[model samples]
Target: MNWIWISGVAFLLSFLAAGVLIFFGKELEDLGITGNIYYIILIPLGFSSAAFLAGAMKSYASFTSNESVSYGKLQLTGPIVIFALVVGGGFIMPNFNRKEQFDVKMRIVSNDRPMTTLNEGTVTLYIGKEPKTVNIHDGEVAFYNIPEKYHNRKVRIVPAINSYQLADSNEVLISKNEDYVDIHVTRTKESLSTLVRGSVLDQKNMAVVHALLDFSSGLATCYTDPNGNFSLTVPLPPGEKAQLKVVTDGITRFNEVVTISSTIPIDLRIDKTP
Candidate 1:
């Protein structure tokens, strides 16, 4: 009776899950994003396994109540079969990242006092031996599913701003884990810092200290020290040029377009003339 009750509940839940996924699939298709078949079936697989476990737990109580050994064994065998399938199927699944794939996505951030959000970056994933690139955007990025043949194999995920400094994570063992692998990548300030430094001098070539430097929109500002040396940090948007505005005596001094493509200091000379 317990087995019947658990199985009944499991079947209902699995059925509802399948229906919801199927509904979402149509919506996704309407949105023009490709859908995967596994998305709908995996729910049933998981819930059915859970149902078996529930039955086994209920049957254990029957053991002390004169329940037959054979019946208990039968109850246990159901779960064992599901577990075997989950474990065995990990290696036997023919489809991996091939066609009809799912999205593998993650967020990108910087390790700072308050944590800076990295809006754009790129990562690479190896499905089996095949490598694929995923473009990052607005704090998250994804690579659409891989070739199906690599579905049950060990997958490699790597992130590198430059091809020469690529870093790899331990190969992800994907069996019955899920249809997608979400990965998070963090970049230290050392990896993305751009130091802007220069000496603010006056007409006499003397130091013009305490001069104000502003980036467009006044998003960032820095001031020259007594020695006319100023150091500022402004992360130029990836792959773009930005302007730096300096103000002296309520007048615009230097408004120059600069490119910061590396983790190096950009030098500037600000001299005021009468």
Candidate 2:
């Protein structure tokens, strides 16, 4: 009975945790906790495994004891079974008879003209762990029968074209029904001109000149001028986050992630190196 109570408590706690994750998953994701579908399944399975082990230990102890084994001593099975059923049903019941599908439509344009480069390029759309790739045709492509589970979720669209690069707007929110996404690409030579301007300052509120700024693993790099101003273009679209590393006098002073929001100059302040 004591073991049963312990197992029951463990199950309840796990259930509560899973509930929080399910209900507030998006909020948690914003805070960097990747509460994806896998976590939802893993959490319950992990707790159930622990409960099963506890019950097994109790059975072993009882069998080895001088006291005769009784049916009442096996009560741990009740909560364990119930927990398993509830969890399994919660995940499995949703997929049963779920034939709903969604469609995602994409339109590609290059230099303000409809892109008809089927043989020259392909676009890949990623929803969670699933990736769908389709060749661009007639300036458009459509993905059909996408599982309804991904409705309203965010997706990443990447376009691969010979001598052409995506200009802007990659990540998009998938709609509940038919979704439409627009992508723009430009020639590689014409793409590198989107510049991001910024400045680096030290603890004394003074400009840190000669500071090296690297973005997207050196996809773009520049050093601060005498007045601590720097400008370099990155290969990422707007609204995408990139890793920004700042080195001053050959010593890394600031290393952080930054979101590419706009052309407005970004001001970064760091502690002066000793």
Candidate 3:
């Protein structure tokens, strides 16, 4: 009949009930409140429920602890009913809030294609209407801050990383109280339609066709034709003058920075190192 002992028992029962409701409460409905900030409410509710149960036990004991050890039924009922309500409500509030929520797990699929990483390694993530540019490593990313309010909403995701394009925008429908999303995206190189044609030559005026041409990250093993002439579609990033370095063994590296002023082949001559 000690109120302190009774309060401890109440706390234990409340903890157990909350655990069961959160983990296996599917029979009540898959409220999906297993892991969320809403659970923080249970902390204070547990203490309040235990305190109420303790007070009820003290009041009930006062009626019967007169050595006659007989407490009127009506005296017991009030405390018992209040204890039930307090503990019961504590377990339901989170579920009520969760009834509006769903979870999202997003993984950016790069179609198994290798990503050409730049200095700024980042992409844009669109959650509902909010857009955030998040850094990505290994082409994988995850987010857990979604609220239940975003449930059943249409979400469009796109990668804004430079040198890479999503190929197409990916749209996903947020369905269910828990949504596991696998975003299918094909990371293709951002397109450049312009072509640059040229020839590589040595000091002897010989075709340096086998010369290795380094154009940004995309290397072109440009070997000259029989006439010592080589041409390639330029893959250099646009909006700036691009340079191609001719890397040959032993000889000093030769290169030229040129803008394709015309569609006609721009003749390039790799002069000997001065």
Highest TM-score scorer: 3
> Arrange candidates by lDDT, highest first: which order?
2, 1, 3
Query: lDDT at 177 for candidate 1?
Result: 38
lDDT of each: 0.57, 0.70, 0.55
What ordering of candidates by TM-score runs from best to worst? 3, 1, 2
Q: Name the runs in model 1 displaced over 4 angstroms.
A: 1-154, 159-192, 237-240, 261-267
Clash pairs, model 3 backbone: 101-148, 209-223, 209-224
Q: Write the per-residue lDDT of candidate 2 for residues 121-186, one digit (tens) a residue.
A: 778888656577777777777776567887888778888876577787687777755455767778
For model 1, residues 71-131, the per-residue Cα lDDT tens digits are: 4433344455565576456335755643554444444434321213444456667764556
Tens-digit per-residue lDDT, 159-228, candidate 3: 6655455555466765555445555554345444345667766777777656666565454446557676
lDDT of 1: 0.57
Off by over 4 Å in 2: 1-193
Clashing pairs in 1: 95-148, 96-148, 96-151, 97-146, 97-147, 98-146, 98-147, 98-148
- Look at candidate 1 and tell me the lDDT of residue 264: 44
Q: What would you estimate as the lDDT of candidate 3? A: 0.55
Model 2 C-alpha RMSD vs. true structure (Å) is 17.3
**TM-score for every candidate vs. truth?**
0.35, 0.33, 0.40
